[model samples]
Target: MAYGIETRCIHGEDGITREHAYGSMGTPIYQTATFAHPGVGQSTGFDYTRESNPTRSELERIVSSLEKAYDTVACASGMAALSILLELFENGSHFVCSEDLYGGSVRIFSTIGANRGLTFSYVNTADAELVEKAIKKETKALYIETPSNPTMQVTDLRAMKALAEKYGLLLIVDNTFLSPYFQNPIDLGADLVVHSGTKYLGGHNDALAGFLCSASKDLADKIRYIYKTTGGCLSPFESFLLIRGIKTLSVRMERQQENALKIANWLKEQEEIKGVYYVGLPEHPGYEINKSQARGFGGMISFHTDTAETAKRILERVKVISYAESLGGVESLITYPMLQTHGDVPAEIRERLGITDNFLRMSVGIENGDDLIEDLAQALKGE
Candidate 1:
């Protein structure tokens, strides 16, 4: 039967039911450490837990199907998946990436490149020309994030795809914020897509997980090799939990997006707020490009107030929204990018990108939009 994402999510990869069997509708977690082999020179799907697991495989298959990719690899964390992908490049090979990305990603790249003599140049990928200009002869990959971190700056995936094709570079997109339901970069020509499943896909702020999806079998195999050898695979239990979380993604995202729109609109009207950045609003710099690609604007929003003092006060006083770093959960979270998500970013770069001390980011939740608005109104009053 043809089904929507919400339906597939609940039933996806959970497996067929045995007739007359009394069982839970949810996918059971297979917590065993290893599986037995059929015989010598024969494999029974899973031989070692480190290499593979039935639970993880089911989650991987479901995610791959959701992303419309040939295959996917689930990892212990998002950074692990990123590490496996970066291993595809030889030492000294260069990568071009978005200047404003998740803080952890930036730190990982900097540390790895410093040790291995690998190179990366960060640029404003929102500007197509700048991205094209940043490509070098040794450039092997183009890494990007849309509705990027604190800035909510949108990148043109189709434009990036064209540049990658012209330069024979692999395009990798971080589709964490929008997830597959809101934006699937593979559909727009990305060779691969990555996610910090700990955020949205897991939904409840529970299990930590990550995934990488690829359309090319050869590319998939390369990633799989690194994944298996590095032993960064997710545990079967976590995989099953993540699968359960993903079943509610569509519903959660819908409510979150709606709440975000309301919050963004309210923030824009505040006198203390300098600017609001969200793709849903037409006045945003990235709105046009974002509209061209995504089905709807996502749940993340960031705004700059007049000063750090006001921002701090607002964060300190916010009632409904928790002061937290992560985004894309059922609970609303507010973070000061300068101190939290993008703290590791160079001050000079952060200033240039407008991720100043005055900036505050919000990941709206499924709660009543009116309640969220009231909470923010009170917080702004205290500020």
Candidate 2:
């Protein structure tokens, strides 16, 4: 029987048959570096850990199923996954990317990619015309982050897909903000879907991992080749943790979204708050577009305090929410993008994107909605 997404999350799409690992209910972690050959010429499917491992393979399969992709490549980190995807283009090829992306992404593209002779043009991808105008003959890809990191800018995937088709360019989406449970970019005609599995997919701030999923066999093969060659694959133990985290993704996302909406609304009512940038809020520019394309508005919210001093005070005073860098964990995290996630971005660009000292980004967790709101209220009140 075909199952719903919730069912798929728990039992997986294929329903977890016991054929793979000697009837064990849970997928076994294959920790060895190398596998022995059955005979002189025959060998086990897995030869080396760097090339492939059973545990990581299972994690990749589950993620691919979730994204409805032909295949997925598991990597050491989100940047590693992006590095593999960038390998599709030749050294001199260029890409048009979202202006307000994660700071680490911008750092890598500007430093590492630039060192390798790859070039990128940063634009607000929500404006399809601007993205089109930014593309040159050397541009090979349209890379974007929807409900963009820290800023919560949403890009229309269908519009980007149309542009990519017209220019014969690949459409790569960073789906880290909204996990596959809320948004599936591949279903919207994305050529490649990338994620930071360490965030929502892991659910806990425990493991570090990344994933790249694609429906095109050719693209999948190219990613796999680069992934194996670079040797930045996720460890088997981390893969096991990722699988455990993914099982509860549906329930966690629902609770997180609920809490986020309440918090965002409460923030808007507070006199100390300047603005709230959450896709769920009707005042947000991309609220309607996000509603049309995604199942949920997601739990990430960025708000500005009346002053930079107030922002710093709240960061130090929050007892319930941890002051941290990462997001999408069970525990709520509040980060100052100016000195944290977007610190690497140039000052001019950061100012233009509104990632300023007065701004704070929150990743709402599965905590009780009222308690979270009360905690924020107390923090804002300097109690």
Candidate 3:
């Protein structure tokens, strides 16, 4: 019988597999560089750390189960996983991608992908017609990031999937924002799902890891071969941390989402706040579409302050929230997109996306709701 997400978060493949060697309560870290073989003709499942490790394999299995993927490959970082995923296509291949994406992703596609003779066209994938118009004869895939980075633009996954099917293109989704507990794009017809495990799946600020979960076995086999060949695998220790973090994913997301909704509503009522971009809010442009596609609106929020000075003041004055770049930790983090996450992005595109000096992105944590609001209130006072 299929288990619920909360149960999966804690138990994983516990009774289904003899994964733990000693049947330990926690997944043991196989902290060795190599494993021994019984004989020349036979072997253990693992050979070298670069190829595989029992600890990492167990984490991959757990993620695969959560995602309902044919297979999942864990990598050193989100960028590494994205780099490997890009390798699947040949030279001169083209892709239609979400316009409002993470700055790092835009950097990669414009530089490394461009250098490799790959081409990409960025469009508002939330509008299926625009995405369809961007497709070319050379297009091999439709790449999307829903509730897109910092700005919170939600895309229609099923619509994108239909476009991909109609055009014979692969549908790849970055599910990092919602994680597996709240959203599974594979179930929505995405060919592959990507995650920055360092964020939600890791659930803490401690470990760094990435994952690429494939819906098709053929796609899984291809990426697995590239993964081992490229050797950007996750460390056994980090894998152990991710496994521990994932155990608390359901609870963490629940509290975070609750906090985010309250904060977004409060932001909307503020005189100095110009706008709030959070899917959880019913007034958000993509709220209904987001509701149709995802189980939750997630904890990420981006808002525009009345002035650049007000934005700066909050960054300096906030006592409860930390001024940081990374998100999805137990601690709430507020970031300046233009100065931090989107600094590398071109000025024109940044401006078009409303990532200005007055814009602030926030990642709500499992903290006291009233305390967080009070902290914000104090920070925004007299602004």
TM-scores for candidates 1 onward, in order: 0.96, 0.98, 0.98
Q: Candidate 1 on 1-383: residue-level lDDT in tens?
A: 65676666666633432211367676667798877778899898888888888778878888987888999999999998888887888888888999989999999899975567789899999999999899988898899999898798899999999999999999999999899888889999999999999999998887889998998999999988888899999998899889889889889989999989988999888999999988999898888888888888889999999989889988999888899988888989999989888888999999999989898899888889999999888888893
Error of 1 at 135 (Å): 1.0
Candidate 3 regions off by >4 Å?
Answer: 14-18
Show model 2 residue runs off by greater than 4 Å. 20-22
Candidate 2 residue lDDT tens string, 169-194? 99999999899999999999999999
Instruction: Tell me how many clashing residue pairs each candidate has.
Output: 0, 0, 0
lDDT per residue (tens digit) for residues 62-115 in model 3: 999899899999999999999999899999899999988888888999999999
**Candidate 1's TM-score:** 0.96
Q: After superposition, how far is residue 237 of candidate 1 from its true place, in Å?
A: 1.6
